[model samples]
Target: MSDSNTTDFTNPSTFILLGIPGLEAAHAWLSIPYSIVYAMAILGNFTILFIVKMEPSLHEPMYYFLCMLAATDLVLSTCILPKMLAIFWFRSREINFDACLIQMYFTHCFSAMETGILVAMALDRYVAICHPLRYSTILTNPVVAKIGLVVVLRGIILFFPYPFMARWRPYCSTNIIAHTYCEHMAVVKLACSDTRLSNYYGLFVILFVASVDLAFIAVTYTQILRTIFRLPTKDARLKTFGTCGSHLCVISCSYIPSLFSFLAHRFGQNVPLYFHILIATVYLLLPPMLNPIIYGVRTKQIWETLLRLFPPKGG
Candidate 1:
C-alpha cells in the first residue's frame, strides 16, 4: 500500500502474486492439504506455548525464550500458511494492496525477531554450559524480556520504512508479486523508482544483522567447545554438547532456508519461480514445525515432563 499521505510518489493501485501454480490451476485439490498443514502449524505451536506456560519446571529463562520463539512462529506460520493454504484449497487467494503490506510487515517482523531470539538462546546455552556460575545472573527474566523488547523494536524500525518506501514510488501499472505474499524484495521490485538504494540498504541490513548475531553465536560456541574440551570426563563433554544441540539444530534449520532464499532471490537469476516458492515457504514454515520438536525431543527435562504428564494410556 502506498502512503496515502505522501505526495511525491503515487502508490500502485494493485499488486499481483505468482501463487502455487499448476495448483492455482487446481486450487480445489490443493487447498485441502494446504489448510490442513496450516491448521497443524498453528495447533502445534500453540500446544508448545500452553505446555511451557503451565509447567513450572519449564518456566526457566531457556523455556521462556523457547515459548517466545514458539509464539513468533505461531505468528509467522499463521500469517503465511493460512493464506497460502486457502489459495490452494479454494482458488480464491485475493489480498488487497494495504492488506498485503500489513502482512509483509508482520511477516518480516516476526521472522527478524526470531533471529534475535535464537541468538539469545545461543548465549543462554553458552552460559548454562560454560559459565554455570553466571547462568542465573546473566539470563534473568528481566534481561530476557529486555532482549525481546529490543527484537521487536528493531524489527519495527527495519520493516516500517520499506512499506513507506514502496508507497513513495509512483505506480505505472498494477503490480504482481510472483510466489505468494507481499515479499519484501518482490514488492520493492515493483516500485516505479530507482530501488538501488533500498536494495543496497536491505542487503547491508541483512548482512549486518545476521553477521552480528551469527558472529556472537560463533564466539559463544567456540568458547563452549574450549570449555568442554578442558573437561576431563566423557560424560561432561556429552552433557555440554547435549545442552547446545537443540539450539544448534534450531539455528541451522532457521538460517539454511533463509540464507538460500536470500541468495536465490537476490543473486540467482533464471531460478524457476517454483523454486523460489518452495524455498521461501520452507524458510517460513520449517522453523515453526521443527521448533517444538527440537526442544521436546532434545531436552530430557521437557520430554520427561511431558511423558509424566500423560503416561501410556494403558499399562
Candidate 2:
C-alpha cells in the first residue's frame, strides 16, 4: 500500500476510510442503513448456501456452482461490510494499512473466483441443456473438482500483480481513498511513482479477462439457446433458460455496473464521486445478496429442500 492510500494517524498503524463525505458526519443515522444492508446481504446468501447443501436432489453440477456462488457472496460481503458498517456506525474509519491491503487482495481474489465460478456454471448449463447424454461424462465430480481448483488459482494469480505492483513503487503520502474499500486501481493510483504502466496493465487484465469470460459465457448460452429451440415443448425451452436464470442475474449484476462505472469515470465530469464509489460497492454486495435467492428459490429441488429445512411447525 502507498502512503497516498494512508493517513497520518496518531497511531501510525491505522487510517480512516474517507467514507462518503457527507454521510460520515452522521454516523448514528447512517449506521441504521448500513447495518440493514449488511444484515440482509449476509442472511440472503446464507439461506442459499443452506438450501444447496441440504438439498440432495440438487447435487448436480449446476447447483454445485450455485452453492459456490452463494458461498463466495456470503464471504465477499462479510469481508467488506463489517468494516464499512463500523466506519458508518461508529464514525470509526480506522483500518490498518496492511489490513486494508490484505482486505483488498482477498476481495479481488474472491471476486475473480466468483467470475470464474459463474463461467463454470454457464458451461454446466450449456452441457446439460445442449448435450444431455454426455453431460455426466463431461462435468463429473472429478472434473468439477478440478475446475474449482482452477478457479481459486485463477483468482489469486490474476490479482496477485496489484500488491506486487504497489510494492514496486515509492508510495505517496496521501491518505484519503476516494472509495470505501481499498480497490486495486485506487490503491495503485495512490503510488507516487509513474502508474501509467500499472494502469494499462490493470485495464488490460480487466478488459481481457472479464471480457473473455463474458464472451465465452455468451457463446455457450447462444449455443444452448439454439439447442433449446429444437425441443418439442415450449416448456422445455423455458426450463433450459430457467436453469441459467441465476447466472444471468449474476452476470447482469456484475458486468453492467462495471461498464457504467468505467464509462462514468472516463466520460462524465459532473457525476458525483460517491455515485461511482457507491455503485461499485453495491455491485460487489448485491450478487452475494441476490445469488442465493435468484438461484435457490427458482430451483424446484432447492425450494423443496429449503422448505424441508424450515418446515411449518404446527401442521
Candidate 3:
C-alpha cells in the first residue's frame, strides 16, 4: 500500500471548500433554507418518478422524458447538496482529492444530461403539437429509451476528461475552493499549471452541450409557435399553449440561473464572490425543486393523479 504521508506534487491530497465565503457565521442559518430546498428537490423528483412509473396511462413519450428529467434532477441535486449540507451543518469542508474529482464528474455529467433531456423533451413537444398524427411513430418507447441512453452517454463522454485533466495539473498552492461543491472551473482555477487547455475544453463543453441544447429548444419552440398560430380555433391554441406552459416554466427555471451563473463565473469581473457562489448554488438546486411543482400545477393528468392519491377527507 502507498504511504499516506508520502505526497504527490501533481495531485492534491485534499481540498478545502470554503462554503459561502464572508458568511461563515451564517452557515448554520443558511443550512436551514438549503436543507429545505434539498428536501423539496428529493421528495419532488421522487414523487414525479413514482407517479409516472405507477400510472400506466402516463407511460408515454412525454412522461418518459419527464422520468428522465426527474432522474437527472435527482442526480444533479444529490451530487452537490449532501456535501453542501455537510459544510453548513458540521463544517466538514475538507474533501479528499479523489472524492472531489468524483463529485466534480457527477456534477458536470448530471448537468449535461439534464440539458440534453430538456432538449429531448422540447423535441417531444414539437412532435406532439406539430405532427400529432405522426407522434407515436416518431417517438416510440424504444426511440425514447435510445434517446435517454444517448443523453447519458454524451454527458459521460463530455465530462470524463474534466477531472482527469484537472487531476494531472499541479495543485501546489493553497487548495481552497470558493464554492460549496466541486465544479470543474472552480477546481481547475486553483491549479498551479497553465489552465488554457482546461479552460478551452470546459468552455467547449459548456457551449457545445448547454448552449447547443438551448438553441435546439429555442428552434423547436419556434416551430411549435408557428404551428399553434395556424390552428383553426382560439381554444385549440389555448389548450395547446396550456400544455406547453409547464415545460416553458421548467425551461426558464433551469436555463436562466444557469446562464447567469456561467456569465458571472466567466465574465463578471465586478461581481462579488458571494453573488457567484449563491447563484451557483441556486442554479444547482432550483430546477429540481421547481420541476415537480410546475408539472403538477400545469399538467391535468399529474394533478388529477396527485388529487386521487391524496383524496379529500370529506369525500
lDDT winner among the candidates? 3
Evaluated at residue 295, the lDDT of candidate 1 is 81
lDDT of each: 0.79, 0.77, 0.90
lDDT of 3 by residue, 1-315 (tens): 754333445666888899989889999999999899989999988998988887889999999999899989998999989999999988899999999999999998998898899999999999999999999999998999999999999999989998899888887666789899998888998887899999999998898987689889989999999999999999999999888899999999999999999888779989988888999989889999999989988899998887888788998
Q: What would the TM-scores of all predictions be? A: 0.91, 0.90, 0.95
TM-score leader: 3
Per-residue C-alpha lDDT of model 1 across residues 1-315, encoded as one tens digit per residue: 774323243564455565754345655665565566667767767777777777888888898888889889988888887677656655444677787888888898788889988988887888898889988898888998998889779878877777776667666544657667777777787666699977887787788888988898899899999999999999989977888899999999999999999899879899877778778888988888888888888888878877777687883
Pick the winner on TM-score between candidates 1 and 3: 3
**Which residue runs of candidate 3 sit more than 4 Å off their true CA positions?**
1-9
- What range of 10 consecutive residues in model 3 has the weakest lDDT sum? 2-11
Q: Write out the backbone clash pairs for model 3.
A: none
**For every model in order, what is the number of clashing pairs?**
9, 3, 0
Model 3 RMSD in Å is 3.1
lDDT of 3: 0.90
Residue 128 displacement in candidate 1 (angstroms): 0.6
The candidate, 1 or 3, that scores higher on lDDT is: 3
Model 3 reaches what TM-score against the true structure?
A: 0.95
